[model samples]
Target: MLIAAASTIVLAVVVWATVVNTEGWAAVQRFFLDPAIALEYLSKIWDGFLFNLQVLAISVVTVGAVALVIATLRTLRGPVFFPVRIAAAAYTDLFRGLPFVIVLYIVGYGIPTITNTRFPPIVLGVLAITLTYSAYVAEVIRAGIEAVHPSQRLAARALGLGYVQTLGRIVLPQAVRKIAPPLMNDFLSMQKDVGLVSILGAVDAVRAAQNAASQSYNFTPYIVAGVLFILLAIPTIRLTDWYTARLRDREQMGSIV
Candidate 1:
């Protein structure tokens, strides 16, 4: 603690000395780190963050649900379900191979062009993010499913469990638990990807910041927007770390439940 305090104090002193140069400090103060400008921008954009959060929450839930279905389909065997499996494979491959921007543009603009009617920006954003992330989430979950011991499935069958029952009762629970950290990490990514939907002209934080920056003729609002995302993600990062540690502990000690 003492060492950290001393280092912080030393760093503060160095920064203070650097800023002591009046001309350079004035330019820095005028452009980037001015407290008043940052505060004003924050105030303007804070409300728009609610939209981002709304889109993020909706997208994460939808993607997780869709991906679970897709992952389950990917695990199905037997000739009867071969066509279903092929369709699932094709869906994941198509979406996962596309860049987010290209997907976003296609959904946001192309759909409107075809239907001759534009959906709400938030809706378009949610659709794009859900489609894009579901593929990735499916792969994450499929990997978790593959990592489970084959004996678990065999034992489930031996116990008179049907395939669906085995999957629901025995397999996915362990797989999801094993992959929770990465799932939450993707959610962290989803939180920020919500901002990308702003390209469709949603009143999200990024769009709000862009508007504020235009009005002010300064880019500080963009910095404020970035800082907001970082601040929001900090808790998720810590939780991911803590969850990971707990998972490691569970491996050595046994399942929490």
Candidate 2:
């Protein structure tokens, strides 16, 4: 432990020294690390960041609902449900294959053009995020649901539980526990991508940074925005790591020797 701590400290110091010793370091610092500029734009960027949080909050709820429905469809059995499963599978494939930027452009701009109905940029941002993330999340959820042992389902049925009841009472709880780590990872990614809504002309943190940079011709505001995002993500990142480790320990404890 001592060796590890010392090595980490040395590595950090070496990297910091290398950065500071670069020929263009001063110029880079002047442009990208200006304290005054960061301080000046912090308020505006923070306001925009609040908008991003709002979008993320809405997208998380909608994505969960949509993804659960898609996953449930994919998990349905019997020939009668084949088409539904196929449709759900196709939806996940199409969205997962397409770049999120393309989805954002389509939902944010193309839909409005086709329908001739202008929606708020925030609405479009939330919709775009939901459409894109729901696919990835649905796949994760489907995998989780399928991971449950077949015997569990059979046992539930033997006890007279219907399909929905078995799924809700017996299968889903276990699946959620298994998928919690990856789902948290997806949510972490969502936190970062929420800023992509700036491309839709929403005055999100990134857009606010862009606007501030344009006025002063310095890149410090962008750095400030990036810092803010990092700060916002740190808590979730730490939580994910802690939860993953706890889960790993629990699983190891339960495993047969």
lDDT of 1 by residue, 139-158 (tens): 89998998899999999999
- Worst window of 10 by summed lDDT in candidate 1: 20-29
Off by over 4 Å in 1: 1-25, 252-257
The residue-level lDDT of candidate 2 at 98 comes to 93
Error of 1 at 82 (Å): 2.6
lDDT of 1 at 235: 96
Least accurate stretch of 10 residues (summed lDDT) in model 2? 248-257
Local distance difference test, each candidate: 0.89, 0.94
